[model samples]
Target: MKIYIITVLLILLSMCSCQTDSSPLPILGRHDISETDTVYHRIPDFKFINQDSNYVTNSDLKDNIYISDFFFMSCPSICPIVKKQMLRVYDKYKDNDRVKLVSHTIDPKRDTPEKLKKYAQKLNIDDSVWMFLTGEKGEILDIADDYFVAAFEDPDAPGGFDHSGKMILTDTKRHIRAFAEGTDPEDVDQFLIDIDKLLVEYAQ
Candidate 1:
């Protein structure tokens, strides 16, 4: 009787442990940017303008994978470096119709569609896969907030806009799977690898 009781107790303990481990963790929101080995919540739905001034909504992003970053055409510092890195990414995935890039302008006042078009042309941005978008300042900020990709206006800054240098990777389901520093080469490489893993997950 004692032996049977001990075995039953052990089994029940194991089951309890399993159940405890199966519970989902609390999700962190944009204001609480997670820095640990934590999974991000699903991407929030949004609507914004594309390079062509067309309305691009979350539904349009369905069934397509995309990489996104924020920048202004006239940014004099890290923007150029980030753009250079993005050029490499653009080259790698330009031929793949399944992949696309969205570059949002932090300086909507100066990055009008015409200005953005010239900037894209100057960089030879592969529009087939890459788009330089300019829209209302508040709209861009809201979308950035949803992604937890930080951006703000700094009165002291030359362009008055400050933004995070993250390269956001999203799946076909319009979910953000991963992100990396836009100016970091190793991070960008890891981002590419993550993109492949996300593609596999989406495929499965």
Candidate 2:
């Protein structure tokens, strides 16, 4: 009887252990661990002009988890499909102030604030919810590297530039938590689920 009781208690303990384990999303980058502290890879501060011509910096997004991507207003391929998938994300979380979406223009020279403003208006999204940003071409490309998205000027490529169609999910601490191929609806569908999972982590 004692042996049977021990087995039941062990099983109960295992169930309780499972119930208490709650890391739904792993932080997606490298970390540095010391005896007393662990440091994570953080997105650094940046400044850009949004479609509304307002200055946006890393501080603007403080305390908010966000989705980010890169594109140019005049892209001849892939960008439209990526934007469509991003729109689905936007529609799902538009009312959630805890979330925001940022799209940076790779063609900074041509995609000025006025140009981005016109584009944003066509999408009928509030600038506060989804910001279209323009900044130095070099800075935009540099930040793309931080997000692990490939972007650069290419004369032979479509629209005179080459870039990836990736959407990255970032946490409030600036660590990447999830991402998906923005051109693939199926991947984006999975990404949407991961976003919910990350939010559940915060809710806990």
Candidate 3:
């Protein structure tokens, strides 16, 4: 996760977090510079099965802003804390038609759609509001990098894998807007404000 932090920080260094003048949230990613125009990075296309066993793709979410994260059901360390923060995000926008939450499981071998369904059911959250995803492990890990959430198998780590608990906020255009350390309630409090601010951009 060290590499993920450095990468995110490097991208963040060139951007601002607060739009005090009520501007849109900063797009967080690498940029392709050119004399004519600059092109920003975007979350790459991917697909996975949600808790309902339905296939979900980027095109399905092209019209909505979403929060994305990584986790495994068996995580013995920070998963609970991170999930608590995510629930905060979920409750805040569960009824909003324009928002969704996507959680990709790093341990796809164990965290299947049915398992995810039970997990979601335990929280009493509808799949339309927050999706728990699982797919090919390689694809999952690659997409995790795209979202700046480190995830990989680690024999020495807890639960037999290492991962980051970063909750990422992304816009409809696939640009990352804001993120928070999911283990920190205070950071997530600010993240909630960021979500509201991002929504205001769409309202405009």
Candidate 4:
């Protein structure tokens, strides 16, 4: 009887462990959350110009998981390194329709649609899966805040603007699922794992 009870307890413990391990990533930003609550925060609606001069909006990205980053065509600092890391992600999901990448330019004055198109071509980016976006400076700055990334113009900063090198992962519902330092390959690898986990979560 003791052995039977021990076996039952072991099974229960294993099930609980599995449940903990499989818990979905947290929904970031200010929210009223509880230990038992399952409500999630979502990304707000937005509109911006893509490399192809088309207006890309939040609705266009419905039912897809996307990675987002901020950059400018003229940035001479971490932008290149970050783009390299972003390319790594792009290469991984280039063929997956369910995945997309949105690169926003903080310097909209210089990164017009035409310029952005040239930049994308130089990078050999597929406009369908990867979009290099630009728009009004103020609007772009406000949107950056929503993703928890910093962006602002500074005369002393390199490229005339300063921003964080963060790659953010968002789900179809626009909930931010993960983020990684765009300069760190190890962090990005972990983020890729998280992306897979989110994909599986949504698949079910």
TM-score of 4: 0.86
lDDT of 4 at 11: 100
**Cα-based lDDT for every prediction:** 0.76, 0.91, 0.91, 0.90
Q: How many clashes does the backbone of model 4 have?
A: 0
Model 3: per-residue Cα lDDT over 1-204, one tens digit each: 999999999778756653255666799988899999988878989889999899999999998999988999999999999998899999999999999999999999999899999999998898888999999999999998888788899999999889999999999999999999999999999899999999997885
Q: What is the lDDT of residue 159 in candidate 4?
A: 82
The residue ranges of model 1 lying beyond 4 angstroms of the native Cα positions read 1-40
Of 1 and 4, which scores higher on TM-score?
A: 4
Q: TM-score of each candidate?
A: 0.76, 0.87, 0.88, 0.86
Model 2, 15-63: lDDT tens per residue? 9888944567888777889899988877878999999899999888887
Q: Number of clashing residue pairs in every model?
A: 0, 0, 0, 0
Residue ranges of candidate 4 with Cα displaced over 4 Å: 1-20, 33-40
